[model samples]
Target: MTPNTARRNEASRRAVLTAAFDLLQEVDYAKLSIEGIAARAGVGKQTIYRWWPSKGAVLFDAFLMLSEGAGGEPPMLPDTGDLEADLVLVLRATVDELNDPRFEPPMRALSTEIAHDPELAAAYAERLDGPLREAKRQRLRSAQQAGQLAQGLDLEVAVDMIWGPVLNRWLQRTGPLTTEYTDLVVTTALNGLRPRGSSS
Candidate 1:
């Protein structure tokens, strides 16, 4: 397609996604529908179905777009060669994004659905979770190579150490997810949450 056509298509797609995002805030996942999305988007119902197989798919992509700079599909992590600083930088940004109203509603809905639906969970794993996990894992691997991460660290668990608390506070809304809290998570996870050299 020509550049103009490509741009127009992108704009139209974004409009559809934006409409879906807005609708998701007002309705639960089970109630969300492609017909409803197309109505909200000012497009034909077939337009939505032609592009996405399910409402979940549409919302997942919408969330991905909204969360782009907020630790989801970020162009790059804060790689200053200082692992703690880098991690704190990214995690702090993530906390701020999670706190934002734009990312909160759809995120809450999608996560809630994932708990009860195995099929949606698997689809989420393939499309959403895998990429995000891989991104975190890549950053951790970089830290290890830089000699900042612990040698022979279980990369998966190490990733959880960094990701868990931030997500916990963000999703559960149980505690403050301040920059200070993120900084502490960075320091604790990297240097061990216990006394120096003591197993956590």
Candidate 2:
């Protein structure tokens, strides 16, 4: 493709993503349609179909884009050699992101839709959960190698335990999502993972 063509394509893609994200905040997922997205994006319906198969697919990509940090940096789990500190940092950031106005509504919409749609849930897991889980798994592995975590520990379970409380609270709206809560969760989880007889 020529340089100008590539730029135009990129611009169109960005416009579509932005429109989908904004529309999610304005309309319920059940009410959000591909035609609406195309209209809001100032592109034809065929343009959206040329890129994604369905509105769910478009919304999924938009969610992933928003999760990317400012300037489009990929979402990351920090590894600072201190497992507890790293987990705390990551979870605290998660709490903030969950509370952010731009993310909260879209995420709530996606969560609601995913609860009833297996295919969309699978897509969300593949596109968003996969990377986040892998990042946490890698961090746990590093901790194990450094003797910070107990040997033979199930890293997957460890990742879930660390995140379970925070997610539960977010979804249930049962409690405030504070940094202090995240710090406590991280500390409790790390305490369990630490080598036997080692005090955290």
Candidate 3:
């Protein structure tokens, strides 16, 4: 496509995605449809089909774009050289984001839909979880190199240890997310999982 055409296509795609997101905030994901998205975006229905196969894919992409921001890069995880501080920083930001009703609903809806739809779940795992897991692995590797983590730590397991408790709490609404909560997670993970000889 010509540069002008490419730019127009990009603009149209963004318009549709934005409309989908707005509709998600306004209506249930189960009630959302391509027709509504097209109407809201002022784009033809064919324009959406030309790019995405289903509303699930469109909503998935829209959520991904919204979560990742309009920019291409994933949101940064902090790396302040103090692993405990860095983890707390990022996780607290996560807590804030999860607690925000706007961010939480779309995520919850998508997660619920994925649970019932095996194909959607696989696509989500491939498109979202896979990249996030790799990013967490890199963060854990950096901590390991800094002598902050136990030698031969399983990076994937380590990521789970850090994320699992917080995610459970968020999903269950079982506890408040506070500085105290974050401190406990960081301290517990380090002390329980890291080598005894390792220093904070």
Candidate 4:
């Protein structure tokens, strides 16, 4: 493609992704449709179809774009040499994300939909959950290598242990998801993982 054509294609793609992201803040996932996205994006419906196979695919891509940090990289958990502090930082960010008005409604909507839709669940896992879990696992492994975590810890299970409670509260709405709650979860999990008698 010519330089101008490539620039135009990139611009069009950005427009669609931005429009979809913005629209989700106004409407639930069930109410979001390809036609609405195209209209909001000021592009032809075919323009979106040529890029994404379905509305869910478009939303998934938009979600990723929204979650990206500076330089278009997915947000990374911080590494501060203190495992507990790092975990708390990451978990607090998660709690804030879950509480964010722009993200919460769509995320909750998608979660409910995924429970009944196996295909959607798989897509969600592939795009979001799987990568996030892997990132957390890698951070835990780093702590183990630093001798901050107990030897022989099952990193995968440890990751689940760290995230499971936060996710449960998020999904069940059984309690307020606050900074204190996240800090408590992180402290509790790390206390168990730390080598015996090691200072937290």
Candidate 5:
């Protein structure tokens, strides 16, 4: 495509994703339609259809875009050489995100889609979850190298152990998904991950 056409296509894509997210905040997902999204985005219905296969896909892309929260490179969690502090920062931020009105609706929506749609769940793993998990594990690896964690500890399980409780509470609504809750999770999980005799 020509440069102008490429830019226009990208602009339209951004508009559609943004519109999809905004509409979910205003209306229930059942009321959200491809036609409505197209109208809100100021693009033709075919334009949205050309880019995304379904309403869920548009919403999925929208969720991803917003979760990223910025452009250029994927941002990494702060590595201050203090593993406990870094983990608490990350999990507490997750608490804030799960509590966000702007994000909750789409998060619930995406969770629903993934549960029912295996293909979408697979794509979510590949596109969003995989990269984020890798980054988290990278942080954990750094801690291990610095002797913050047990040398034989499995980072994969460590990642899940650290973040899993927060996700379960958020998804199941079993309890408060608060910073205090996540703070406790980090403290508890880190206690296990820390090397013997290493002060947390």
Candidate 6:
């Protein structure tokens, strides 16, 4: 495509994603329609259909676009040589995002899709979860190297142990997702995850 044509296409794509995200904020998921999105975006419905197969796909891209901002990457977990402090920082940020009204509906929608839609679930695994989970595992590896965590600990389980509580609480709505709760959770998890002493 020509440079002008490419720029126009990029603009339209961003506009469509923005419109879908904004509509999800204002309307029920069931009420969101391609026609409405196209109208809001000032693009033809065919333009949306040409690029995406279904409303779910558009919603997925919109969620990704917003979550990634302009970077085309998920935000990285910080590693400051202090695993507990780093995890607490990451978890507290997660709490903030979960508590945000702007992120809630789309996150809810994506969670539903992840539970039932195999294709979207795989896409999420490959595109979003995979990178993020790897980052967590890498940080855990650093802690192990530093003698801060168990030498033979299973990274996956370690990851779950560190993060599972808050995610469970958020999804089940069993408790408040507060910074205080995340702080306590991080401290408690670190206590359990500390390097076990060698036995005779």
RMSD of each: 4.2, 3.4, 3.4, 3.5, 2.9, 3.1
Q: Candidate 2 has what TM-score? A: 0.80
Better of 2 and 5 by lDDT: 5
Tens-digit lDDT track for model 1 on 56-89?
7787778667656376433556667777777878
Which candidate wins on TM-score?
Answer: 5
Look at candidate 6 and tell me the lDDT of residue 91. Answer: 90
Q: Model 2, range 1-200, lDDT digits (tens) per residue?
A: 99999999878888899998998778877798888999999989998999998777787778777767345554567788888888888888899989998888778877877887899899888878888788789889988999988898999898889998899899889999999999999887876654756453
Better-scoring candidate (TM-score), 2 or 6: 6
- Over 4 Å off in model 1, which ranges? 1-14, 25-35, 44-53, 64-74, 197-200
**What do the candidate models score in CA lDDT, each in turn?**
0.80, 0.84, 0.82, 0.82, 0.87, 0.86
- Of candidates 6 and 2, the better by lDDT: 6
lDDT of 2 at 14: 80
Model 5 root mean square deviation, Cα atoms? 2.9
Cα lDDT, model 1, residue 176:
83
Winner by lDDT: 5
Q: Please provide, for model 4 over 35-150, each residue's C-alpha lDDT reduced to its tens digit, 9 standing for 90 to 100.
A: 99999989999999999877766767766766563355554678888888888888888888899998887677667767877887897888778777778888888888999888
TM-scores for all candidates: the values are 0.76, 0.80, 0.79, 0.80, 0.87, 0.86
RMSD of 3: 3.4
Candidate 5 C-alpha error for residue 84, in Å: 1.0
State model 4's lDDT: 0.82
Clashes of 2: 0
Task: Tell me the spans in candidate 5 whose CA falls farther than 4 Å from its real position.
Answer: 67-69, 193-200
- Look at candidate 5 and tell me the lDDT of residue 159: 94
